[model samples]
Target: MSQPSQALQIRTSDGIVFDVCLEVAQQMGLTHSWLQSERGDLKCSDGPDDDANVMPLNRVRSDIFKLVLDWCQAVQTVDTPLEHKEMLQHQRSLFQRILTESNATDSTIFELIIAADYLNIDGLLQAGTQHVADVINGCDSVEAIRERFHIMYEGEIDE
Candidate 1:
């Protein structure tokens, strides 16, 4: 049998600790960089009790970080590289399910985008920005797009 995956602890800005597998952690650019750094000897262990190993993420909130972790875990399940079209299809389906299940708002989605960008998770960033773009593209008019994002129009000021 294969060995159990090493647990990597991450602490969010909200002081929530999440124990993630090494595979998922390695997929995150910032975390992967840390894993490769000489000073990045995070106490990788099988158990989550070791608080000293926790990587603190100052910009990511627990709720949003949880979503990012979930996304990485789910995406990692597909071992093989998929075609471009297939990847887009899978991403769309996964994103739709996440949105429906979480009942996420536009603000939350935007926050997730920011968190993903901060973490340098390219796949997640693409998916989130694509989702926002798709939403705007589907809008019937400029007013609808503004309404969707809760943007209010102000009169133009003199240049």
Candidate 2:
């Protein structure tokens, strides 16, 4: 009989630890690559007691990490391959749902974009950026866009 794969312990910047399944961890390109490069056995942690063996994601905040984990879980795939168009549409829909379900603010979406970039999650990055672009496109003017994203119109300050 085959042995069950152990969960990977991920410690975020805010000191929160999550016991993530190996499959979900694989969806995170950076984490998978890190694991492959290390080639060392990672101690599976059941709780947040020990930090020695936990993979540290210092750039990702706890709330964003939780959202990213939720996205990863939602998009976990089997061996089936999807075409580019279908995949893009599916990713867009999934991202929209994730944002709506989490009641994500514009600031939160922007944060997710940054986190996706850092994590090397291409799909999430693409979808997030696209969503931002779509929102911008929907706006009637620059001020509307700026207001929607809470961008202050900071004029040039005196040197």
Candidate 3:
């Protein structure tokens, strides 16, 4: 007999709930060291308790969680069937659009960084960090960085 599909329930800080495949959920959990026990069981050693089957991510916003989930899904599916090159390209285009749409502001990027770090999603963390670096790299001076990131400098500027 075919086995029933296994799923993992995720509950975000904003009370948003969603379901993902058990494999993907395990992947997400594996990124955080504390989530695994000595025997490699999915145990929350220093983290929040699991609510039945729902893993509560109380520090992550729902929208940001959604983006992180999308990133995870994209990374997981990057090696689809070789015959579906066109579909793969289309998926990549969608991923790029989503990244661009989310990267519209410094605050958004900051939120993404926070979410990625909290969720222990390494790919998103790297992407968010690189985006911040790219923004900083494009600036010519401290003033430009401040302006680009909308930072308020209360101290006197060095000549």
Candidate 4:
């Protein structure tokens, strides 16, 4: 049996806490990766399983984060030629891994945007950005965007 890492913890502002394995915490969207992009061991702010933004951490079930990390890493490295069928296959494999490994409607494809950007995966970043663009472009007006993403535009039009 593998000894679990001591680094994983879930902490919340409400004083809830839970100790979790690194993998479980990561699957919970409580990965250090999700907390912030600080080049350190992935962590929750408070401690293992403290449930800051996440209540009853078991509710958010998705290992898409792991796949996102793998995809970002694969895209950043030049081990495979981008245009090759093999490369597409690799990407597809990563996608499928996310599908199979993750449960819930969350795909983590959106999360890839941040990971790709943070890792400097230009092609992947462009892909993610473009996908977001396509989604936004489908909307005919600002109201549509606001409704879809729950954003309040705070812009001043200077004349």
**lDDT (CA) per prediction:** 0.83, 0.87, 0.67, 0.50
> Any runs in candidate 1 off by more than 4 Å, and if so which?
38-40, 44-51, 156-159
- Give the alpha carbon lDDT tens digit for every residue of 1-159 in model 2: 999877888889998888888889888998898788764667644555666667889999999998999889888852578899989998999999999999999889999999999999999999999999999999999989877877776673344
Candidate 2: which stretches are off by over 4 Å?
Answer: 44-49, 77-79, 155-159
- The per-prediction CA RMSD against the true structure, in angstroms, equals 3.3, 2.7, 6.4, 9.7
lDDT of 1 by residue, 40-147 (tens): 665546565655677889999998887888788889889899999999888777777777778899878999999989999987888889999999999999999888
User: Once superposed on the true structure, which residue ranges of model 4 sit more than 4 Å away at CA?
Assistant: 1-65, 70-110, 154-159
What's each prediction's clash count?
A: 0, 0, 0, 14
Record all residue pairs in model 3 with backbone atoms less than 3 Å apart, i.e. clashing: none
Count of backbone collisions in candidate 1: 0
Q: What is the per-residue lDDT of model 4 for residues 1-159, given as tens digits with 9 covering 90 to 100?
A: 987565444333334444454443443233545545433544345644344444332322224234444554444555645666666556555555544555423236565565555434454555556556766999999899877776766663344
lDDT of 4 at 142: 85
lDDT of 1 at 99: 73
Ranking by lDDT: 2, 1, 3, 4
* Angstrom error at residue 6, model 1: 1.1
Whole-structure CA lDDT of model 4: 0.50
